[model samples]
Target: MANHHIDIHHVAKLARLKLSDSEAATYTLQLDHILDYIAALDQHDLDAAMPTAHAEAVFDVWRHDEPRPSFTNEQSLANAPKKSQGQFQMPRVVEE
Candidate 1:
């Protein structure tokens, strides 16, 4: 990867952030440093390295299914700020 500069004003606009001239200048250098680090990482050799799916090995670590005592409906709803019947009430959500 070649060294490149990020357009701080454009980035700020995309992220809906307001930055002063000094802040934009500071962030431009910081973003450039980050990109430089990524470029350096891209030059690493990994031909013989095994790909790891996760940071640590994961096996049958789940608990076996077993019945356990749980809070009753009344107990569950007792602390809710809003409740309807025996269930917690929530505000309606609108989806795009």
Candidate 2:
């Protein structure tokens, strides 16, 4: 287990969270415990093991690329911040 004190306030600020002093202390301990658990993996010898994303065999089960019904132009443009002539309007992206 790692013996390091975490700066909970810094973490909370970065995550845009407003944590009280008690909450910060609680989270600090919880985060430290999680990190200590992860550090325990260092004791394992993983040289012979193959890295995998999952423990079991996984195959791509993809749906066929076929035409399907989609939202209409009105439905698509309904949420546009700025629109004109049935299309999204934005500042010019290129200069002549």
Candidate 3:
């Protein structure tokens, strides 16, 4: 990879960050290191490799999404502090 200089101030501005000159310099070196690592990874011979979300295959561990028994309307509202028209009553929130 070419030695591309990253504009730390520009990056910080885009990310809505307030970085000082020293901080920007530190981040620039860190970003350069990260880019170097990526460059090294690009040298790997993996033309036959298929892209995947994970390094290894992953199977779903969840159970089947089948419907189960639920509470009746009266049973659901039975413990409510206030109820009207078979529903929980909440205080008015909006003003006229």
Instruction: Return the number of clashes found in candidate 1.
Output: 0
Per-residue CA lDDT of model 1 for 1-96, tens digit only, reads 328789989989999999999999888998898988778756889787999999989987987699889999999999999999899999878776
Runs off by more than 4 Å, candidate 3: 1-4, 55-96
Tell me the tens digit of each residue's lDDT in model 2 across 20-51. 88999788988888887787878999989988
- What shift in Å separates residue 2 of candidate 1 from its native position after superposition? 9.4
Residue ranges of candidate 1 with Cα displaced over 4 Å: 45-96
Each candidate's TM vs. the true structure? 0.43, 0.48, 0.44
The CA lDDT at 39 in model 2 is 76
C-alpha RMSD between model 2 and the true structure: 6.2
Greater-TM-score candidate between 2 and 3? 2
Q: Output the lDDT of residue 66, model 1.
A: 97
Candidate 1 structure lDDT? 0.88
